[model samples]
Target: MRLRRRVSPLKLAVLGGVLFMLVLVVLQRDVSGGIQEPWFEDLSNRKERMLELVRGAVNNLAFQIPGQPGTPQLPAGGEVDKNCPSGFYTQAELKPWLERPPEEPHSQGAGGSAFQKDNLTPDEKKEKEEGMTRHCFNQFASDRISLHRSLGEDTRPPECVERKFRRCPPLPTTSVIIVFHNEAWSTLLRTVYSVLHTAPAILLREIILVDDASTAGGCGVYQERR
Candidate 1:
């Protein structure tokens, strides 16, 4: 048998080294590129960069006050108070500081006494009635009459007046029921004002307002005559 050529150990070692280098290159391309570095590994560097950016922005916007060590500038024409470093007052903060009328000595402990005293006298009752007369006549009675008269007149064109009148159905009466649950006094009064202004007397028979379990003290006050 012919003798087979034997491979050299040196050549085999060289080939093995080349093969190992190729495998490492393939791993670096496929696995190393896909892996993300952990944030903990570079947290200190990232934090420093973020702090630098914030400090630069604040320095750009910050104004130096005269004779003050580190006071940020406020808007133009704004007043600063030593008590409030932020130089702003909320509604609650301003309410106690606002100027108000001097409280009456007689009405100090009386919650509803002022209104009750006015209702106790005959002259006061007459004055109250007179005051309410203007509101009732102008806002309610006259408005309702005007609406009724306007609807009673014919509004059809001359050409179709005769034909339309024959085919027109009778106007139906409507009752507007307003229900309020935990509604504000201003909101309830606005609803009544809107109905008085807009509703025609021919269509609207009556307006009924229903307040269901409201905690407001003056619900039925309007119903009572002076």
Candidate 2:
């Protein structure tokens, strides 16, 4: 019989909190104008309800499966210690995955070539059409790109790079939540890696992923690894 290992309920609860925080960040950041009185009041009133919904969603997303013996958790630490000196988390968390070699020219979407059109053979066209029909996009083309594709360097201006916050009140670390529904495997993973690669571990607490009841074959692989 195959062995199954489940992530603890405590861990799943933590996952819920991460997602909850992410939702709050989005709502707060995307407000068209500054927070008005009525909006703030409504948000305050619904805060408990939102927490309940996030807990339910996270529990639904958690799963049990045989553990992969050697999969190292990204940004391996559970939480960033504020007391640590500058660059401590950066040195610890920036692994070889972020320093990947450049993709070959033959790789789809490499070197800004994704926009270039290719003359498709009849069979290729039929395959592309079928992929689009099933996933509502070109899954065939997406399959050709690496999941860990490089997105090039961070583009911060020189002034932004030079500015530093006070050590006494270090910037708060954040958890990134990615919610996907039947997304292409390559695109989904590329997004995950992109954040991991770009975001400094000093300011990134963790990544929480939520799959919203996806029934596509592309999601099967992730489910199997749960």
> Which candidate tops lDDT?
2
Model 1 sits at a Cα RMSD from the real structure of 32.6
Predicted candidate 1 versus true structure: per-residue lDDT over 37-146, tens digit per residue: 56433543454577699987665433322223333554468765544355222333223212323334343122222222323378655654553563332222221121
Candidate 1 regions with alpha-carbon error over 4 angstroms: 1-167, 219-226
Residue 50 of candidate 2: its Cα lDDT?
81
What is candidate 1's CA lDDT for residue 117?
Answer: 36
Per candidate, the number of residue pairs that clash is 0, 0
* Candidate 2 stretches greater than 4 Å from native: 1-97, 115-117, 152-157, 222-226
lDDT of 2 by residue, 1-226 (tens): 9999999999999999999878876666545356666776477547758878987766433311112333222244555455543332234443423555567666656654563448989988898898899778777767666655654554689976554333322446788999988777767877887887677766778889999898865444532110
Angstrom error at residue 210, model 1 = 0.6
Give every collision pair in model 2.
none
Q: Candidate 1, 132: how far from true, in Å?
A: 30
Backbone clashes in candidate 1 total 0
lDDT of each: 0.46, 0.62
- Show the colliding residue pairs in model 1: none
lDDT of 1 at 37: 50
